[model samples]
Target: MRRIAGVFLAVASVLGAQPRKPIQDVRIDILSTMLTGNAGLGEWGFAAVVEADGRRILFDTGARPETVLRNAEELRIDLSGITDVILSHNHGDHTGGLLTLRRELGRRKQSAISKAYVGAGAFWQRSETSVLAAAKNAYESGGGTFTEVASAREIFPGAWLTGPVKRVHAEKNYGGTGKVRNAEGLWVEDNLPEDMSLVLETTKGLVVVAGCGHAGIVNILEQARREISKAPVHAAIGGWHLFAATDEHLDWTASKLKEFGVENFLGAHCTGIEAVYRIRQRAGLTRRTCATGAVGGGFTLKDGLRPGTLAK
Candidate 1:
């Protein structure tokens, strides 16, 4: 009987049969960001470790491979167990630490980064030399794997990746700059079609985690609600690439965020300090609900938020 019970528990873990806790119980630890953490260092990059639905996922590699490693050590976090990773886009700042994280962490745990997830076109040729090429090649050569996400799908029970967000709005988050191969295999103005975000579903609402948000925050939110879940947005975290927005754009974005039921925000990376403040004021959010993300900062269902700076 004991042997049978042990076997059942093992099977449950392997098959993800353990009854899920509330989505709010999931905690996200910001591993790298522009803002300072208690002990971790900052950089002009973004990376996080999301602990949700009993899975530990490395969201994005930071601008420098060693920066993440150094920060993680200072924060007393361990990456040896990260079996899955996600590349928000193909930019260097985001994909810098892929090889390092996989190699260093995998040394301790054989499956440190066995599988990676990315939006479609992450590997498409760019007019300029793509930074993601070398790292991805090295990773694949070492038997690492990748999954190109094209549409919205729940990668885990409660975690969904908004694959290739639809640009129904005029935001033009990327300003249609750069050059990337489009469907016809022609290089065109790169709107970063592969830019995507992570959506966490909770009983209260959804938590959207954007990486650069080249797809436009409004578009990501609307699409998440349209295709992923009807639940209201509880929080907007991570990078949104709003550092260059004009006052008019910020105003519209703030109003739209309020309309989308975004009650909390922890803007980091390309989300400039001024932008966060303007958005907070325009959206009528209190300091408790809006703050600036940092290296060691994070958010959870219970504690709400731990940010480096708060909206005044």
Candidate 2:
């Protein structure tokens, strides 16, 4: 019965192709300070390093290449060791230092090469006004490879980039001084262009690394669950874009995340103090500050929380 055998094989293939269960051994390194200048007020940028299956993937080069480089040097994070670089979105603060980083890594002896990953629309999103175009051009000119994805894709085994999360919640009224304006002189609404987040299938649960959460942290979490089938969110570290969030918005986000069993949260950069406090007040959350000048100040997926060692 060749026909019957073919049907059975097709069904097996469909089930096997489903997204695999959770993954483990994911680590995120905060390479730069959360705030650029002062303790509370400063431009925000973050560098996230993800380690999965013995490969190093860098996500988002901070606002300043020097800062990222210096932090990497101090942390002993070898830039030459990085294999992939993922830009979350096309903002200057996220991609400003990419050029410098590429140059530095290219000079290494081992020549640990890096490929740039981003959303397809990132290139055409008002490139003149945004630094994304510059970053892309620099990487391409440097002989580095580039890849574009329209939606979530698995970059490594059990490691996924949740591309362009759909904003399901009603838009919240939030404004800030660092808002980006388009060529029309209008503040771009939260049309986050396929903002990506890293999802690591951990033995404990899923570890989510967010750049700015412009795609909405709740949306990221929901998509992660749908992708991996409700695996516990072990930890979420990076900018939450909560500085401008209303109290109601903050409360709702906190309530929603609580149900997902997020155990550790390292709030930094755009996550306002008030929002951090709200998240800390919730049960099962341990808060750690990820400010600038905080060398050796990162958490490990295997070792758990690590406090900020920045000098006062």
Each model's Cα RMSD: 5.6, 4.7
Clashing residue pairs in all predictions, respectively, total: 0, 6
Candidate 1 — which pairs collide? none
Estimate the TM-score of every prediction: 0.91, 0.82
TM-score of 1: 0.91
**Which portions of model 2 show Cα errors greater than 4 Å?**
1-22, 35-43, 109-113, 171-190, 287-295, 310-312
Candidate 1: deviation at residue 211, Å?
1.1
Q: List the residue pairs that clash in candidate 2.
A: 23-201, 23-202, 24-201, 24-202, 33-292, 34-292
The lDDT per prediction is: 0.86, 0.68
Q: What TM-score does candidate 2 reach?
A: 0.82
**Candidate 2's residue-wise lDDT over 1-312, tens digit each?**
999998998998888865565555665667754543222223468676777757788888888756676667666778787768888877777887787887877788324446888865565544246777766666776787778777778887778888767677744322333443544656565365557788887778888887777777888889888865478887777777877877777778777878888887776667666777776675335444222223345567677655454421
Candidate 1 local lDDT, 35-129, one digit each (tens): 88558788889998888766888888899878888888888889888888888998888889888888888888888876889999888888767
**Highest lDDT scorer:** 1
Q: How much lDDT does candidate 1 score?
A: 0.86
